[model samples]
Target: MSWQYVLELIQNILISQTGIPHMTWGHGIMLLIALFFLYLAVAKGFEPLLLLPIGFGIFLVNFPIVPLMGLNAEGHMNLIEYFYQYGVASEIIPCVIFLGLGAMTDFGPLIANPKMLIIGAGAQLGVFVTYVGVLFFGFTLKEAASVGIIGGADGPTTIYLTAKLAPHLLGANALAAYSYMAMVPLIQPPIMRLMTTPEQRRIKMRQLRPVSAREKLLFPLIGCALIVLLIPMVAPLMGMFMFGNFMRESMMVKRLSDTAQNSLMNIVTIFLGLSVGATMQAEVFLNWKPLLIFGFGLLDFVVCTFGGILTVHIMNLFLKEKINPLIGSAGVSAVPMSARVSHVEGLKADPNNWLMMHAMAPNLAGVIGSAAAAGMMIAMFQ
Candidate 1:
């Protein structure tokens, strides 16, 4: 071959094999966004477990001509696409994550104070309200439902519902849910303080009654039955959750429980995060819809926090022993983080006032409430 022909062949090889020739402004922006997420996860310690894998996935898939999130020439699904299709789109990973959460959860606080269930349900006010609000902004019923559930602060439920109803919006919804969840410490405290007085924050609750092992073991069965009867659409997610909890409470299957809580959970989490982040391809994510979702998500969370505190004030009018309004903010299903925020806020108000156990009642209740709300929406739309 002539030297000129060889030079042209080498240039063709570089263009085909490297992303540089195919890169666009969109890819550049997405890469920078991925790096920002990585920095947050690594340096700022913001939801490191999920954000790290998600950020990496975003980085990998954004490279032009990469097979990470698409089908190959032979039509075989690429790596992240396989994970997205089978694990996330098929609605398996989120339920599996719930199983792990159930395995690690302690339901004693919720069982001891069943009334906290109202606060949990109350916190979902934003879900329905935002549902109505978003429809005015031109989102369809399914998309609005998916967006509204972000208020619950339950990442798995958000993923689960969005995958079922509006799979196109999954990445934005999941990111919004987790981002707000990670910021629970910052987002919730101010609302809690503004909603309650010093005396209300200082209100000390009585110690929860001791729970018998029999009660613990029976709870999952009873809770599952009631939830399924009420909203059968949620059977898959709730079934796995209660089954995992049953295994934990039984003490007869310690190995299974441990595996669910640690190994299986971690494995599913990696796939889930990566799959989610891969969906944020610049063309899909950098749009007005995702921006609106993010905006409504923050409003939904704020209103949910406000609703929870408001519910407490209303309940106290009839409650013989008043609850600390601060615990109401824990009614969003960020789990122990929101509960701890309540405890810390209480401690600030009264150094001797301990609210962790009490806050847990509403926190755990929020998990159930959010799942139930997801079930309700599925039933309505599906």
Candidate 2:
């Protein structure tokens, strides 16, 4: 071959071998964002289970000319695409995660105080509010519903609903849901403080009644039947959630419960985090919709936090033995995190005040409430 032709071939191979020639500013920006997420997950230990894998997924998919997602030339999907399709799009992974959550969760507090269910339902105000708000932004009903669940602060429900309703926005919605969830400690306290007075925070709650094993076992069965009957669309998520809880409470299936809580949960979490992160490909994520989703997500969390506290205030006006409004803030479904925040704030006001069990009631309720909201939204699409 001629030297000139050989040099041209060498240049072409060099260009083809590396992503640098094809990388754009969007890719650069997204890579930096992924790195930041990694820093948060690794350095700051912020939601490391989800964030670390998600950050790495973003890093992988953003590389130019890659086929980390989508179909290849032969029309078959790559590895991550398969993971996304079956794990998320098929809606199996989220349900599995719920099973794990149920296995790990202690629903005794919620069983002891059924009234907390109202606070959970009340926190869903942000879901509907954001649903209406996103309509003005030109998102269709399904898309709006998917985006609004970010307010409920339940990441799996958000993903499951988004996958069913608006798969196109899955990457953005999942990222937004999880990112906001990680920041619950920061996002909730301000609104919680602003809405409640010193007296409300200092209000000492009565000790939660010790729940019987029978009540614990019956809760998932009755709760599942009631919720599913009311909102069947949530059957998969709720059914799995209750089943896991049942396994834990049943006392006959200790081995299964342990596997669900530890081994199975850990496996699904890794898949979920990686697939979710892979969705943040630069072209799909670096758009106005993601920004809008992020903005709406923040608003949803704020409004939900407000709604929970407001529900508490409204309830206190009527109840003889009042609840501390701070516990209501835990109704946003960030699970133990939001509940812990409420407990910390309560301690700040009164060192003797212990609201963990009380806050747990609403926190557990928030899980059901978010799943119900998801069901309602999914019904709209159906």
Top model number, TM-score: 1
TM-score of each: 0.98, 0.97
Q: Cα lDDT for residue 365, model 1?
A: 91
Per-residue lDDT tens digits of candidate 2, residues 85-167? 99998999999999999999899999999999999999999999999999999999899999999999998999999999999
Global lDDT scores for all candidate models:
0.94, 0.93
Per-residue alpha-carbon lDDT of candidate 1 for residues 114-232, written as tens digits (9 for 90 to 100): 99999999999999889998999999999999999999999999999999999999989998898888899999999998999998999999999999999999999999999999899
Model 1 TM-score (2 dp): 0.98
Give residue 85's error in model 2 in angstroms.
0.6
Error of 2 at 55 (Å): 0.7
Q: What is the lDDT of residue 314 in candidate 1?
A: 97
Best by lDDT: 1
Clash count of each predicted structure: 0, 0
